[model samples]
Target: MAFIANMLMAVYQTNISDLFEVVDYLLMLKAPSFKSVYKWRLEQEHKLRERIHAESNKTENSHVMTDTEVWDFIQYFQRITEECLSEMPARANFLYELDDSRKIKFRLSNL
Candidate 1:
């Protein structure tokens, strides 16, 4: 049970780390404001850190995980990663559209 729990934590940490990296990449694209993205990224990172800390505490307290529980957690984590991955293209497109709108507004203002 402990081994399974550790494995689940490892899987979660790795996949979530990858997701954050992808988010950072998405934020690098031209956007109207870096402040919002930076704030959001910090919040996400804080939440991730808090979650990891809580999980570590639970593990250290010897909370056992049944095989079914482990399986369920793995499935949940995989789904979350997939959802994040699928949203990346949409986010990129939105950023592009935002940049285009800003350019159009600037041109209109000058005219």
Candidate 2:
């Protein structure tokens, strides 16, 4: 999805306060959407190369990002997110229906 690509770009390129806000959402994608994400990853890798060549540094880290950081982040996030999605509902708060006319019920989990 384009939204996923944009969200990753924002988190990768900007100093967002929420360190890993929407990472869980990335778990929803299947095989077809992989190319968009792969493209973004390629762009980040290219940026890392350019930064290295130009002697550019970001903030206090003395580095921008390694080629594997994003991939590793995704791998870990995917595992944890999958587990949470499967198990968190059992630990969720009990939610009550507000009105008798409404049939649907759900708990709002943390993103």
Top candidate on lDDT is: 2
Q: How close to the true structure is residue 15 of candidate 2, measured as C-alpha lDDT?
A: 56
lDDT for each of the candidates? Answer: 0.48, 0.48
lDDT of 1 by residue, 1-111 (tens): 669768877997789777766564443133344333344444555565567668785444344444454445455445444554455445542333234233422211111
Model 1 residue 42 distance off true place after TM-score fit, in angstroms: 0.2
lDDT of 2 by residue, 1-111 (tens): 569767876775575336445444322211222333444665777777677767754334545556577666565355334554454455434332222223334334334
Worst 10 residues of 2 by lDDT: 26-35
C-alpha RMSD by candidate, in order: 15.4, 16.4
lDDT of 1 at 15: 93
- Cα error, residue 103 of model 1, in Å, equals 21
Q: What is the lDDT of residue 89 in candidate 2?
A: 50
- Pairs with steric clashes in candidate 1: none
Candidate 1: regions farther than 4 A off:
1-31, 58-111
